[model samples]
Target chain A: MLAVDMAGETVRAMNGSMVAYDGEMTFKRQGMTGGEGLRGALRRRVAGESMTLMEVTGQGTVYFASEATEVTLVELAGDTLLVESDSLLALDGRLQTGVQFIGLRGMGTGQGLATTKVEGQGTVAILSDGPAIALEVAPGTPLCVDPHAYVAHRGQLQQDVVTDVNWRTVLGQGSGESVQFRYQGHGLVYVQPAERGGILEI
Target chain B: MTSTTFNAATLPANDNVNPYAFSVDLNGQWFTQKGKMIAYYGQIRFQALSAGPLDMLVAESFHSPLYAHDWIVAEGQGKLLLADRGFDINSYDLDKGNLTIRAANLLAFEPGLELKQSIIPGFLTLIGTGRFVAASNGPVHFVEPPIRVDPQALLGWADCPSPCHHYDHGYVRGVLGAARMMFGVGGTSGEEHQFDFTGEGTVLIQSSEHVTSSDAMLRELEGQIGMLGVPGLRQLHGTIAQRLAAEQQH
Candidate 1:
């Protein structure tokens, strides 16, 4: 049994079957550019059926999630964490301020991101469900990746919404029309190794 | 009870109307017969409150905070959203003109209407007749049935002669007798439980202003014997009680 020290914070299941958290809990993560072989390159896509739980605490925030059949616990800041859910979230839980969860469907895309602020002296833990790779970007740097090829991250990351689509992307090659969840805060980000979507759903 | 009466035949008329209004207040029962929202404050028998103009009964409830929905009545058919889930639904006995539902789900109620312990279909949420209460608030106050109410929220007591603590009747006949009394409320009897609401019920609600986790809840019962005195302070006492229990052991 994992004890929640906080009242509300966002959390989602990760590869390690743990929950990762932040304030304005986000759905997208930033993947690294070049360098590592397919192992690091392929870590950009792959997330499975996930639900995020967050609670608020006087000490800041605590989060919990069921990982590859295991339960994970973590602490987070006011700026990280997001909520995204569809039919998966039943009424057994509650939702609080400063947290969010995003549910992604292969045939769907919408602006489900929320606004938030995270900062200063806070302890946070991110659980990688499978093997996850971390990528860091310095201030004033712009990093890009396939929309479906990344996990969670901190920093002033903005995903611009666009409707116009190119022929190749629209023809099932995956929508070439993409938006970016840009990062900017001075915090560590956790990204799972996968490309083109979560680990092959079996 | 004012002698104000309304005539159904002399009411307004309309066509192609399904939703409607049913009002029961101090004067009597009035039906707009063609609106989505309807409110009442007293007792009255309704002809029909359904798709033929569904029933929407909202009242101040002799209990609870804001407004509330009480019992709904139709001539031969009716449906009432008595509790929170589908499990608490009760089908109307058209021939008997009665709609029976459980009691516990009746958190708060309106005047003239009662919160009763009726037989609800068995489901995950129901056990034994799932307790409920029916009440009203217009000209007269009523405890529709013998309901098992929490001793807390008993504000001030009136009639009813018996000791306070276990089972006791209402103010129907007696005015004072030691019934199993719930503190702060009048009527039959209940336990020395704290009063929590602002309105009426099987137990009267105590008078309290705002409260957070840190504030004293049972603030008004400072001099009253058997009361926790203050809600927060009572909790503190519980902690102290545990400490005392431990100290004696050593």
Candidate 2:
């Protein structure tokens, strides 16, 4: 559960994710574009990374939850966070949500070829099957993550899909660890303990 | 509550970073089950057990030919994180001792431990000194035996020499019991059968009774089918057909 204390400040959350509020509050569903204007709506439609958000303005504490999954709050200071639309829960109104192309890294998880990018300043809450572990990447140390477990990433990182195909894979005796996402640069990557069963068995 | 962000330097070395994930400070190599690795930092290389470079290590520590394909060797420097389908993961340390665990529950173990196939068809045994991680449906409880545990709840046993099938004799004695066994007409308590364990050792049981997928059991049956002659195979096919028909009706 996440509690947001507001003194008449506005926040945008996943539609219908508000569980309860202690103060005077009003929720208005942000239409097709998710408050990103007509261009964002069109982009979302084409990219297939649709996010339905609602504006919540209140004066007291409000609670938000989804599927009883654990929530992790990430505070951003102008850096961009690239996350799957399904994993995004809520974020402050100041953050701008946009779509970015992520290539085949998203193919394994059946999440399409793009991801939602959140920029600007404010706190964003993302959901995960379990608690999310944040791993740091630097020039000296690159990180390899299973695509199914990757939730979000921030900073100046370059990610590419690494496919390890050998003769065994041709014999139908492929090692399940055949595909991975290699992240290099300086940033933090968030991964959940559980893998989202998808096209990639691993 | 706010949780601390763990970076490469903050991640624990060979310890659980949380209840559901474990971080291995991999300076050398660790044998990890397939699909259990969530993320990792540093220069780690994952090679299948059959990979040429790992042939020598596989010969020394891994002995289960049936499951060799299901494991990989993770070698190099940095911290490697592993988890199994969001199940509760716990690490166990062995000091020249042996512990057998459900095949699906064993996630990753240090190369110092020798892994062998247990006598029990769906279980794996680890011997020698080292740390290994296993996942349970719920928190695991350790109980001393001379005890009978529901088959679904028995996770594994450590140093217990005897673990055999035990049936409630009273429920299977008379003519009625014989009829019930022959035909699926009567309803018997599902707990009528259990795994009985004895000797000096600890028995591990998950709080929840959920069992892992039955792929291991299916594989074991497939291996044994080779011993059956044509007539035996025909009978087995007939039995399976009957069972399938009954299931469809339900």
Full-model lDDT, candidate 2: 0.89
Tens-place lDDT digits, model 2, residues A55-114 = 999799999999999999999999999999989999998899999987767776798988
Evaluated on the second chain alone, the candidates' TM-scores are 0.20, 0.94
Instruction: After the best TM-score superposition of candidate 1, give how far the Cα of residue B80 lies from its true spot, in angstroms.
Output: 62
Q: Candidate 2: which pairs clash?
A: none
Choose the strongest candidate by lDDT: 2
Ten-residue region with minimum lDDT total, candidate 2 chain B = B1-10
Off by over 4 Å in 1: A1-65, A69-97, A100-121, A159-164, A172-189, A195-202, B1-250
DockQ of candidate 1 compared with the true complex:
0.01
Winning candidate number (DockQ) = 2
lDDT for each candidate structure: 0.27, 0.89
lDDT of 1 by residue, B137-243 (tens): 11112242233334322212222221134433343235343332323345423342322222222322222221112111222123233554578677878878988
